[model samples]
Target: MKNIYSLFGLLFISQLTFSQATLEGSIVDENNQSVLATVYLPQIEKGAVSDVNGKYLVTQIPNGNYTVIISALGYETLSFKLSFLKNETIAKHIVLKERAVEMEEVIISTPFHKLQSENVMKVERITTEQLTKNGAVNLSQGISNMAGVSTVSTGNGIGKPVIRGLSSNRVLTYTQGVRLENQQFGDEHGLGISGNGIESVEVIKGPASLLYGSDAIGGVLYLNPEGFATDNETEVDGTGSYFSNTKGFNSSIGAKTSGEKVKFLVRGSRASFSDYETGDEYRVTNTRYNEYDIKTGIRFQDKRLKSTLRYNYNRSNIGIPEEIGAQNTSKELLLPFQEIDNHILSLDNTLFLNNSSLDIKTGYLFNDRREFEESADEAALRLKLNTFTYDVKYNLPELGHFTTIVGVQGMLQDNKNFGEEILIPNAKKVDFGVFATTHLHLKDWDFQGGLRLDTRKIKTEDARNPQDEDFIPSIDKDYNSFNVALGAKYNFSETFTGRLNLASGFRAPNLAELTSNGVHEGTNRYEIGNPDLNNEQSFQTDLAFEYRSEHFEAFANGFYNTINNYIFISPTGDVIEDNRVFNYVQNGAKLFGGEIGFHLHPHPLDWLHWESSYETVIGELKEGGNLPLIPANTLNNTIRLELNDGGFLKSPYSFITLENIFAQNNASEFETTTKGYNLLSLGFGATVKWNKIEFNWGVNATNITNESFINHLSRLKADEILNPGRSINFNLGFTL
Candidate 1:
């Protein structure tokens, strides 16, 4: 600390203006134009990270010449040098090439089921390779296949993803670091995010309010946009893929063009599905659904600045049947349609300085969603919400060993409810937050931490001729919360890393939880609002161990989280004094779980691959009661045979998974016990070339036996219906 202070003091006093030139530039992917984080500086250091905007500021060089080298994972490296002048700042841009077998480094290699990944607790990751190779009608199906993650399927069409047994607003969703805006309270609001354009899915289990903002208590699912080279060096290049399954059919197309000054990328996909059948040959009715999405982006690359404009539109029709006891025979389907149109435009600029640089990034986001019911009975439960977000941040790395990422985010949101609404209020909410994160790397260990303070202010106005004499025409609710985290990882060896983490996190009550007043038919709830609810706070701890080998990588972790003032709706009737309806409130709570993952290769040849994973989670309240809908013990085992020039199979690739999701029985209140079952699946894929075009063909079978068993948390399992039986899917994709 003294040394740092002395260095700063000297720099301030010894202002001997050394006329040195600075090199400032950015490295971006050819497709999405997103910045590459991990960069190899070669001369100064082997590994350095580009700022969040894909920009890097290198300084402290004399007029003498030097070489600059930049390399990113999954892409080729480039080296260049320029003659410099005193007090001059030069901006440069580099575009990298993509490679398969001989990658610069793997950008994403971790599986979503890993338990002890890095130092982050409950963290999960899905790579682009899995997204492209696996044949799923939608992204939700693939995510639910991971250990410890389940789905609350209101039939196949409206399945909300649950991690460790929490969904809706409890777990926040993001698209490329942007928060997903949808009705987080309802079970049928799953189609708001379009999965077609996502290249990766990262699940951060447990409360992530430290990184994300409010409503991340259950965790966060981040759908990252593609930032890889889908096009070659040619003028214009593209890829197309088609897929089919017993329940649905899907197709995708993408194209990109690159030039000296600009680049453009566009992608789109459409999918439609019918009701799915269970192992007993019973069809889950009202499961039919269809959705389409389109995304386009333009990038301007220059010596001094790089900017991108992105627009995405997603629309889907979801059919849901009202749950009716053991006989789910509701012919009146509630067609809750969602047309979420989102747009974001951003610009990042860097000003080069000697020994330091200043970076500024600003972005704007607009999200809109409108809801309608196909049936009149469900019309009373409709809503429309529109939100706009503006974010900005500045980065200055002049201070060594400490880089601060501070940003201000604000949201302007308005919500409306239709129907014979009891207490429906036309309301608006403004959310503002300031957050900062710092990374400190040690010789043998690294430490990272962050803090954020967020506030939400909501204003409501209600007016109707039928209003009761005592009814109030206005409402105001303000919520504020503080978030914090601290963690560190120790590098034991070249391939082994172990980490331990402890953090305190909290999330403020959302606008809906605090201001909602109308009845909702989705959950069959005579809902009410609570204006006096407090923020939910939690304490978390994590321990992890990981290993990486030439052909094998694995991780295992155990984590614990205990919450105070846990929020939920009690079964009590409305309190009399205020004549307010019943609402969800806060109480004390506890949660704990663990996960284990591994990959082993003992074969004489390198073509054989074997992997296995397991995860379990449980929750309880302060007064001693189990939390609802938590995932049970889950297991997954997979093996693959690859035939290269000389390997295990006649084809390029073949794989199989003996997956088992066991429900030992729920011990919590209002819970039902379920029998355990094992499900086995098989898959295969091969590389084929048509003339100069190369393509991939993939096919997979799920539940080869048509297993008739429900997972521990499946809602239908509460009644005798367990799970959907056997299904098969196939996909064909081509790339240049």
Candidate 2:
């Protein structure tokens, strides 16, 4: 402890005399009156708050071209770019316009960071605070509230994200600017991400291959990690939560500190849960799970170079819930469970040139997965995957109201099996892609377009000999494709906006689709692969409209997508070792969907808010058959009441919500129809100050009615299992 303090002391002393530039700015209302606001620089990870005089100052900033964002309550946000020189003190003033609600947030998933209202493509964002409100148990469930998004759930512990009728390898997930590559080809495999270190989630509902690469044929879910504190600031926070239904517990602690030229942060968290109960008061045995994770990062910046390094280690133990068993509530897992350990390391660097800048990112990932079933002495299956990836992007100098960016990305991966059963053969894969995009900003309209090309190669080792009963031959294949996207946003009127986008995406066949030849224990089926399968290509067109006013806000979004050579699994007439046999096949498919929502806050009672949203999707093959694992239509309604600051309560809020899911009678072969159900939920939250320290707390109750129902996407739906119900959750957090 003494040595640690000394090291910190030395680091703090080193930053006391740093040489850098400072940016100062003031904000004023339309009447030229002073307005207190927040001034933030995203790239520099520094910010300042304006005082009563409407003046804010951020010091120790590296010299470079930077975008500054100024935001205040009840006013429109302002964003602009300027250049700063070494040891220079620049001053600027900004005037704000009054708005009924807060301005839209800035989106970072795109090649060019811009406010959602200004971007040509529509993106959905959910913050950590919003996740907490939903009382979710995992990262996938945390995002299930968004429109056009759901989950293929096993129980309280396992869930895979489904976006616009797509799941598994079809959808892509990114964390800290690097693609997440776990063994996601299986139906029971969930996203191995902890919500503790994540600050927010951004979802692109349609194909984003022009920015991302192959596998993005469906969409992208981007997780933004928590950032460091501002300059010369230090903070520590602790949080705890409890759940009634599962007897679950979650705890975490984090600390961050930033100096003039150095910044660092660390966080540790743990969570555990027992078997979850159904609405009928019956427990789903062997559904228990536990997880532990640690994360740390450090960043340094000079006049022209900024660099950051981050690392995360995660370990999880999940039980495979099946038929009912004894009713005892034990957190320990029985046989037929999974153990996973994942490690991620990343480094990012940015160099500031005269006008244009270069950004470089590198990452390393290791995934160790083991499944134990029938006995506790040995693992039935074990797979180890290693991946190394890099990305480089160059931003050209702004010219004639246009911003351009060009980039290249690639990955190398190796997969090996060391267990009794091999679901997929040992393989080595390589991927490379290049893209260029440009954005044009006009007075009332914005236009953006991009093109990308990608190539992938796969080689598998021959694991079978002529003497073996089921010999699989060695395989080598190469896949390549080109994609493009074009989008436009127009301000139809002062209170209305419209956006249109057309995009194309492509996906190469995964290892499981090309090599699997045995039973998949997770899905309880024998699967066969096709070596001649072709790549899948998709084209989608999206249109959106938004209307905003002082009393109400409304939005409508629609999409139509078509895919060529869409791969799906069909049951074969033959049976293998008492298990049904399924083969991978391809066909043409189409999907259409739309979402509409409205928010109303009457003038006389602004504290009362009413919101309603509805989403639907239809997917079918060109040969006249329905697609499997399609989500049912859903509608959601919420009523909220907001309270002003009072004696000990600050910004107290309460809400009640109703969710209605429609029956899914349109099912594919080997699928059963699912009955719909309605759910009611309630929650409340408030912040209180004690001894000069503020504490935030909340309580949520889900499935208040205790109704039992099954979800169409539940893997256990075939077994007639019910979803979780009657869970009361409580959470508390405080800063030190």
Candidate 3:
């Protein structure tokens, strides 16, 4: 009898261990005809494709609540939430609507993964595929295409994002679910990231300190990495591109494979560019660059746990152009150049419980920056930065129509100098933050609010060089602040919606702003820091309205920001070492801006699209002077034609765009005004599938008129250097 009882117990345990949930679905169009589509679960990073009969199946799913998305080409995507029980099989059917615009995707930057249409806070999302289709030269230039967004450009290879009218340390960037830090306080420093292997980018146009820590007083840019392949699938792809003006080329190859429980992917990319030519056919000397990048990821999923590990390595050699001289088509770096290398590694894990879940993420990064001015082998300035970060969040069980999340985030960073010049002293920084956010849903309204408290401490070692002007005193300081955010979305009718948000953000003074006593080589200015600087705090109010219909969509967004202790640098009418002396100061400031846009696809002319947008911003100090580096007003218009059904060539498309930049008359004490300019661009592309392989090709021409002009925010504007003009690009790719 004892042996029989033991056998029964063993059988019961084996059954419990093997039990799992399954999800099966069917997809159809509005006409009730079967359609091929992709079904994805964002929570577990699992996906499936519908067959000819519109049937799809996903197995080994854990027993929990999940959001499922169904999407197809030239059709409106569908998203809904569902729950599953252990050892249960659920069946669901969905019907999609035909549309000309792109489908909405799941947002990862937010704590809760929700579709853009269902989110309370307004966010702008753009895919890597779209960026490529739009013919962007780099990641920084790509994001500038969006409304109310621009870039502060140094050359063809270096650019930094500017939201509204704020740049530098005011805006924060996040990649692989962690804050990206690479000494962003300097205007000449670029975003140390590559576009290869990245899936999409999401932009929060206002204060985001409640979600991210300090340095988010302006906004946040979140980059999401590409996902793994579906179960039991393997794929390989390669891409190549060529540019005319710069005589440049970019090449990359990647492969990914997935099993039932494990998945892996890797990619390698390289790019090189020569001196770029201006409208007058004169090459800008030393405006060349080269880059090498590698990305890889691995993932594992089981009944109750899902985990992913990702890594990226990037190296860049960029030149600094002073004047139009020594014209040559060479990709080699000249004097006064920058060499930077970055490494990033991250791990993310999610654990599902009976009615709740926990998410944990950790990241490590290392940055090496070197500048060579006098000698090719010797670096005049070198800075090394290392950072480690962690974030943990707990999702409480949902109650009726309410959902809540509580989280903790922190980071430890160290900066060191190895070269002869010391821009900022060796420093150790620590940060800690805690916050809670909740969402409430009703019949026609969605409400979201959160509160957070953050503390940062910085300690630096003194660097005294009596022989030179480099002397920074040792200092230890701690800063603390509390922030809050509240937003609401209301549906006025079936075709109209309104949203309003109020948020507060803060930023602690960086090492460069708190303790600097030397010449900044890039800006050619002597800077003096104030060790007694206080934290910068800001409050902003945003209002937005959106209208949607079958063939037309429109949106309007406006914001007003008030800042306290806004830090800026101004000349002290003194000169040191042939460089103007500047001192950091703080005062109250205000910024106001708005964006309006509309898209139209007439009923019968479904293949044609017309879009227009206008953006403007104004910044002024409360003491009565225009803030420095504010972007000028701009307008953009585009007309596109889509030929989805073409013999041999599939999904062919073409577009023409016109951009107008208005004059900037408001200038600071040491700034100059800029004149207005217009630019025209054209592009066309198509996809071809032969047997089991697919080929994609495109051609894009920018500044087709060869118009010579200068952007107000260009670092080279001081020298009256023109921007690159009249560049034709050709791209080709294949998938197997």
Candidate 4:
């Protein structure tokens, strides 16, 4: 495309005739003024997410010297290392101080961290204050060791987060990067990802499709809330958790405060469990689980600007062990008057002047749901849904090193099933979109590109039967797609960096994949719908490499996929009396995958930590066939020993882990060949601060030596066993 506007018109005309040197900024919390949406630069290692008000703008070229890092989460991280002047653009604004429970160096000068490694991508982060234990469940058990990610369950109220071999909706969750569009259609919506109110969980593996959008094709997890905070200023703080693992027991609590301008937050948690045990005999009789949660939020900043507001409430009852009938039945998986409610509101702002800074954002979301199971005539159902969402964004500055991102998105819907007159007719649905992006800075090299446009509309309620009663014209449908992305990076020395990306993607056809007919029974199948369907194009590529130094680090990536239409679920009409009707098609597909990671700590001995990961995935069917549930070829590892940083032990630090997972046996196209297993896990932690009060205690061991495997996406089958058998998880908490 004019070579991406002639490489941003020659990197903004060589930053307007070489005179570069101006390091300015603004990222706030303690009443400084602006935090916009979110940001943290790290001398150009790249980090920006603020845009509801707290503004920013970074440029390039031999400007002498620099340092500026501002973080957000509960507030408390701002670095400064001044010196810049050459051809000019300098502005400054900073204020973030709320954490300090006794800094030991505060996790290394805080640049917003969670195990970093980038050149090709290796996010790996985990924070809920190190997983506020207390019966913690969901969000894949708080992303434990990361690396290629893994977590699958139909028990413990079900957990999902498998990457590499992919997971429903081709992975792509991001609660803070937006794009959780109910995960592109069912898997029981995986309990809507509720990790007892999360705060940190980023495992971005591969193909991020340019800042996330679409099904990510196969990567991007995000989910950041509560950035991170400790104490120092005017404040209130909290921590609570209690746990038991063998398949049960949990607790919850929360609180927060920071005043200079304004800041407040609250959290709540509750968990329950019963039924689980199976090493090949006895005790796998319909697992058990439960839940309850509530949350609140508020924020106001200074320096440039900042604002926030949040709310949440949840209720649960789970246990869906294959709805026994031949005599193994006793499940609920989600029922007790089954309920799930979500309401969200957001606003952000940031602006400076004299070089660049302007970012704003707004949001609103509401969802109401009630779900239960079994219906292929066995009868015993319940399904209801209502969703509404709106969003807006913009970022511009550094017209030279280029950083221009623009946005607009929307959604509206209403649904009902089993009410008879509402089976895929004018139930109402809408979607709209717009996008733009740019970012470049040369010398060592870095570049980016983007473009997007989307629109979709679906309705039903049969009026003339052009498929159903048209709330409009037999209820109509229309779709549009246009997307593009390009990337580059080069350094090759200093530690190594060389990456490349080429993308052209699009995904539109959600709303339950075009008018559903119900009887999903949560994967038991029988979900009929088509409505002509189309709009799923894709063409991706990636080749990467990264290497770092401190203790040790490494990353590698390789990918390729070519799809067109690619959406599946076919089998039209046959066996009406025995049961069979499936529909939801769009052929022409292909997929590929790759990933590898490693890290080794250098110091902290007697406080050891090491990590490992390996992954692979391959999907086909452009006439070759063999793509059903796909996910085989995986390996994960973790080893840690921290004993005591609370000195001599007793409460402050203690850790142990030896975990591994390998699942291979597809038997071709899922005729069931899952028989690969090895499991062992152990854990320990302690912390009980004095004066100001704080406490955290944890204990865990899942399948320690009780190995009874199966994970090709097990729904239920004990030909060799899978799930429920040998367990122990515990936690305790308090903070304020």
Can you write out model 4's per-residue Cα lDDT over 1-736, one digit (the tens) per residue?
Answer: 2353354345334332234444456666666666553444432232345555666665442333333555664344455444455656777666765432111111211112211322223345666556544224455655634655665556556566766555666677756334554333555445354565576676665445445455665666777665323212333443433333334555556667655446777777776665565666455444565677776666665433445666656666555655432223233443322345555555544332233333344445454444444332222333355555544444444455455556555566665544333323436667666677675656677666777776767666643245542232334777777777777778778668877877776565665567666545535455666668887777778777877554566777777777788777776765343556677888877778777777675553424557676766677778666666555665666666545445433544444444455555543442466666766666677776666666556776656677666666555543334565556666666565
lDDT of 1 by residue, 178-288 (tens): 566766666655745556667777777667776666777777777767652311233223334433223467777787775544667788877666666678777665556
Per-candidate Cα lDDT values, in order, are: 0.62, 0.86, 0.88, 0.55
Error of 4 at 49 (Å): 23
TM-score of each: 0.79, 0.95, 0.96, 0.33
For model 2, the run of ten residues with the poorest summed lDDT: 9-18
Q: Considering TM-score, which of the candidate structures 1 and 2 is the better prediction for this target?
A: 2
Which residue pairs of candidate 3 clash? Answer: none
Per-residue C-alpha lDDT of model 2 across residues 335-412, encoded as one tens digit per residue: 889999989899988766645567788899999999998777788889999999888777777788788988788999
Model 4 TM-score?
0.33
Q: Which has the greatest TM-score?
A: 3
Report the C-alpha lDDT of model 3 over 335-364, residue by residue, as the tens digit.
989999999999998776655667778999
Candidate 3 yields a Cα-based lDDT of 0.88
Question: Model 3 segments beyond 4 Å from truth?
Answer: 1-19, 466-469
RMSD of each: 8.3, 5.4, 5.1, 22.7
Off by over 4 Å in 1: 1-123, 228-247, 323-381, 418-424, 463-474, 516-519, 573-582, 645-651, 715-722
